[model samples]
Target chain A: MTLLVVHSRLGKHRFEVAKGLSVREALDITALRVRAACGGTGACGACVIHLVGGEVSAPTVAEYMKLGSDERAAGARLACQVRLKGDTEIRLDRPAPPSPWKSIPLENLKPLTHGLPELRAHTLGVAIDLGTTQIRVSLLDRRSGRRIATRRGPNPQGVFGADILNRLEAARANPAHAAELAKLVRTAILRAVRDILARDIGEVKAMLAEIGQVFIVGNTAMLALLGGRGADTLLDPANWQGAIDCRPHDVTPWRAKGALPCAELVMPDPVAGFVGSDLVADLLATGLTEGPAGALLLDIGTNTEIALWDGATLHVTSVAGGPAFEGSGIRHGMAAEPGAIDSVCSVENHYRWRTIGGGAPQGFCGSGLVDAIALLLADGRLKPSGRFASPPGPDGYPLDPNHPNTAITGPDIDAFQRAKAATAAAMSQLLIQAGMTWRELRRLCVCGAFGRTLHLGHAQAIGLLPAVHPGLIELHAEAALAGCEQALLSPGGVQCFDALTAKTKTINLSLLPGYEDRYIEHLRLRPIALTPTTGQRP
Target chain B: MLDRFIKAYNEAVFETDKEAAFTAVNTALAEGIPPEDIVFKIVIPAVEEMMSNITKDPDANLAQHFMTAQIAAEVTEKMLEKFEHPPEIIGRVVIGTAHGDLHSLGKRIVMGCLKALMVEATDLGVNVPAEKFVDEAIARDAQVIAMSAMMVHTATGEDGACKVRQILKERGLEQRFKLIVGGAPYRYDTELYQAVGADSWAPDGVNAARAIINLIQQVKHRDSAQDI
Candidate 1:
């Protein structure tokens, strides 16, 4: 056995592991969190650790390839690549930060003013929006359909992989890995519920007993992974256009595993393919179905889902927008957290920025990246083609002169371009398929954290969103969670979601004609060309 | 004068300036530089240089590679129209994303590079099945079949490149058409191509073009040797 001491932002921890165990494996065995975007393959170089003391195996080829010579000389090595030969001490400088939760506004929700009948009077219900990158949960007072508490955090399953595809591949490759992913998410949800109950109501055990129903909503892949079925079916391209069987064979195990007094744990059926129930929830929250014709709702994340209502029919489709929008894959990208630059603009040739909590800028979130690019374009520092007027140094274009490390690189712009192009192309195709134009798009509802903090003009300036009137655009930060809460409270919520799903004709954009050309055409950082009336109304 | 044209063209392509690249080519043509020289001496070499640079530097700008291929293809198309004698074609290739894979960017880059290198390339688009790939290659009379898979499952799945290899072997067409594979999976594991029964593999679109050209030449040479 070897003694492994890990010093992280979460504090110091010591563990005993067998010889030859990689630091990443040891950390995983101890249930310590380390970001391994490539699932500890050492390909992503995300799990970097500093060797404070003791000896380990020599640097691997992957470590040598991923990390610079200076980094290796300074004792930095990939935790997944370095095996422990003896007692070793390492420091994890960048521990996973806790994702902060924002309570859904009360005014946005329709809470029941009257109490429930005596049988269900004291029972509590929970609503969960299980997203690919983040998970939001709300504890509801079943009596009055009131939200008592809400919690949000990074989905621990992200350690396996950032995108749903990676996790799906991991799950499809190995049953044990799939089981681990399932247990990891379920445990995290239970932990969140327990923590919320402890903080808000006190007497965790009593509150846990009072919880009667847990309603969950997520994308098809997420729901399938959570229920531990339908993942293999989703891997086939043929099944992508049809409704996948995401319902679990049994629900008793979930209730038993959580040891909750809840009589039922309901996860509504996800829509076809990658269009999860979350999108359905977004529609319910925004009331898109009841809206006027030519209304569109976009819930942008790693997997961007767009729904277009053409008065008579609802058209929906999903595009793998990558993780650029949520601030992954960039040089200095991060989620919407404190110290994250959420917005940026230029004031007289100088860049002005604001962080989420008004703290020092740590990194750029999705909206800040958009605004920065738009500002650079406006100032002629960056061309509409996404090239710098003058090539930047190795550190890239610095957003803040004080923080050289916090900047956008060439690859960052490329990543954003692909993401932006895919989103814009999908939107264009949806509009065309519905026989609608930019002028006819009366309402454009943007949902999720990225859309909430996004500057509409900047998003348009960068060709991420359509050039629509300001009044047509509405931002809803927690629309999915709010919809989940609505489903938890209202008896008609499920029916509404079902009707929306039924009316929705999920178009496979890849199979659509001219989608590739449209995608490539929109790759340049310019507003998507608005062509009048390309398709006749069906 | 040719050296100056080459330098100017390479710079414009690397900078992703389409107009500047076209201007450089037109100026060379006006200066009496042969259209073939403009392509063989300028465009092909520019693409090769950019690809070699990308190979050397792990963090190469993908946008630059994409632009280089696009510019080279556009330049080649223009120069072909001005050729005194018909340009000697290298070979034909049928390319597409593997079945169950929707990623087309890598394949598009490869196609553009192939076109610039005077190789006849047919795009089969995304989610292409094994049978479709073989049928298209035969229909197009292509010497090589190229496939791209972005995910691990799609790369190694029953319906991906491996399935194409199986179809080729079953039909005894393995010797006739060479199979080349590339994308995220092959990049992660260099030997994955061998596991999936691919003749060769490349890490990116630029390298994939060079690799396919090599395979096409090999197939043509094998056929000619057999004919003799």
Candidate 2:
């Protein structure tokens, strides 16, 4: 008999359960942090968790490849992989946000050049980036994914709330909010079309003269809300059953049916409701998504999403990292907009960072966060365990509310540490599942738009990424949108995507024992290393 | 006490607080504190705080923020309020959120800073439809009509400062008001202000307040030259 401590993040509740029982069974005992991505199959690694100390319960080969030497050394193990052997701790890092693979479309890929059988070309193809605070729609030439024109505006839906859950919960709270969200999205599209074509607001005919198809990608709940499907309908995987329950993706959900007279709504094939089409498209863009060869795609954003593509299988997981990195969590936070501190440095454990648009930075965003955390880790400003070490150097100082310059405080570091831990843990889970050692990972791909701006060396040094020797990691430019482009470009691209999706076996890592202790160990921001320039953080 | 710190507050020194205002009035009543001090310190800072809170939450209601605004508005009814208040040092500014646009964190921060040292702030809370802007300007005899918007769609659309100018032009009050804009909307194009007929722009509410103050000082300098 083994003891797996299942602790709830919201409440101080923990449940000890027997070994070999699935996390699905544990869900009955404790509604803990694990949000099953693969529908509890050892298939989607989203059920991936951090293993604390215990007898090595062992994960599927797919689960072993996502881990790093440090994680495994720290007693971290995937939840979906190992059965509970003895007294063990298991917990998820903050809910992983959707770190959609940075899938930017190729310049010429499009879904419609007017032809093809069984194609829903009239579906007004649009790939929407439904940001937590802003709604930006890119009207693809679906024929080319060339993004004929892009339109963005503040999410009028934010009038009701911010974040998808907020918008969804708002609709749940008041039906009108649902209607309002729909109205806002369409109005934005209408306004976008008119402005782009320089035509009348209602002139959809003129706007579509050159357009022939449509596809949309957003948070799963958002697509559901847009389709006028309520929460019950939204959460029911049976409605999304083809993608989750069965290995093969059913194209039926994207049949372009909706309550509103809007463009055809193409739902990105979602993993779990949390890891939806954006991520699927993201996975597509990342190239070489799953199998035992072992490659991990970590994207940090409003929702941090990670996927382990082993040579033989793909383990995908997500944690709700929240708005902390995107400049929404802290006071004075902003997006990667002008006046945002997108990059920060260590002034010998103090803090000095640069703004995106420059000027006295109003606040920090994701890039700045990476810089801050990595810098702190290198300079001993933070501990290897992600705790604020309060670098006893001259540059070390406490975070002050009144002083705008006091950017990364002890508390902010913890937020970053937790975020980094979740990310590293997910990656670790993939390596462990693959059964391929970190050195054997063959290649590590940093997948994200933000990943492009990251310092690779800094990432490794701080333990946010595996310590695989450089040259092994290949950063994919835009993995999610690339998949969207693929879906739009080749006639059989969607089917191809469906086939590729089927090949992926989502392994639920949460059910694996010893997840909690591993996550706790990875929480340290201070890496087991040192670098110069740790003294000038101002 | 109020009069003593007005200049420092404007210079961004010794941050301002509501208690400063109450202290001015309380001291004036308790001792032989001058009425000028009472007006400048206690009343002015208090009003600044009142106006600032309306935008602190971005989504907070105007009424929820500044119930004291009405009190300040009534107090301004006095003749001495003019000499004591001096709403022109930073300029006779008009500021508010755009129609159907309500997110006032920056707007109120600007209002608080400006009005703290006597910039007259006409704060219209979140989602003040376009029409009300025109009507209010005429009613208040405002100098600088500034508006804030945080939405990307509205930012590009004619909602905040753009609407203010159209209304001003329509009423033949163009020269009567100096048009201004700020908020999330202005990021795409600064020349957009000129394209949409705005006189000037600022990145945030604080900068917006500062810009108006600078413009007023320039205009004042010209006026003095003409008089000479």
User: On a 0 to 100 scale, what is the lDDT of residue A112 in model 1?
Assistant: 41
Leading candidate by lDDT: 1
lDDT of 1 by residue, A1-538 (tens): 7878889877777765668878876664233545555435578787889999987998888998999999989989998899999999999987433423333333334444433444454378888999888887888886775667666677889888887888888888898988888878888888878766654555577678788878888989998888887778888878988877776676665667445756477777777887888999999888897989999999988899999999988799988887888889988899876567889978877899887544468899889989988888888888766778887856789977898646888789888888888898898889889877877888999987584778999889888888888889998887888887877677664676788788888898988867765676567777766664222111
Off by over 4 Å in 2: A1-125, A131-136, A142-146, A151-156, A199-205, A233-263, A289-292, A345-352, A385-406, A449-451, A476-478, A508-510, A528-538, B1-228
Candidates' lDDT values, in order?
Answer: 0.81, 0.53
The residue-by-residue lDDT of candidate 1 on B1-228, one tens digit each, is: 789998898778766767688889989988999999998999888878877888887667665566667678878988989899988889999999998898888887898898988999999989999999999999999999999999998899888888899999999999999999999988889999999999999998998999999998899898999999
- Least accurate stretch of 10 residues (summed lDDT) in model 1 chain A? A99-108
Which segments of candidate 1 are over 4 A away from where they belong? A1-122, A532-538, B1-53, B67-88
Listed per prediction, chain B TM-scores read 0.95, 0.60
Instruction: Give per-residue CA lDDT, model 2, range A121-225, as digits (tens).
Output: 453355555544555455555443344444445556666666665566566556676666666765665554444333112234445543444555555665556
Interface RMSD of each: 5.3, 18.2
The alpha-carbon deviation from the true structure for residue A281 of candidate 2, after best TM-score superposition, in angstroms, is 0.8
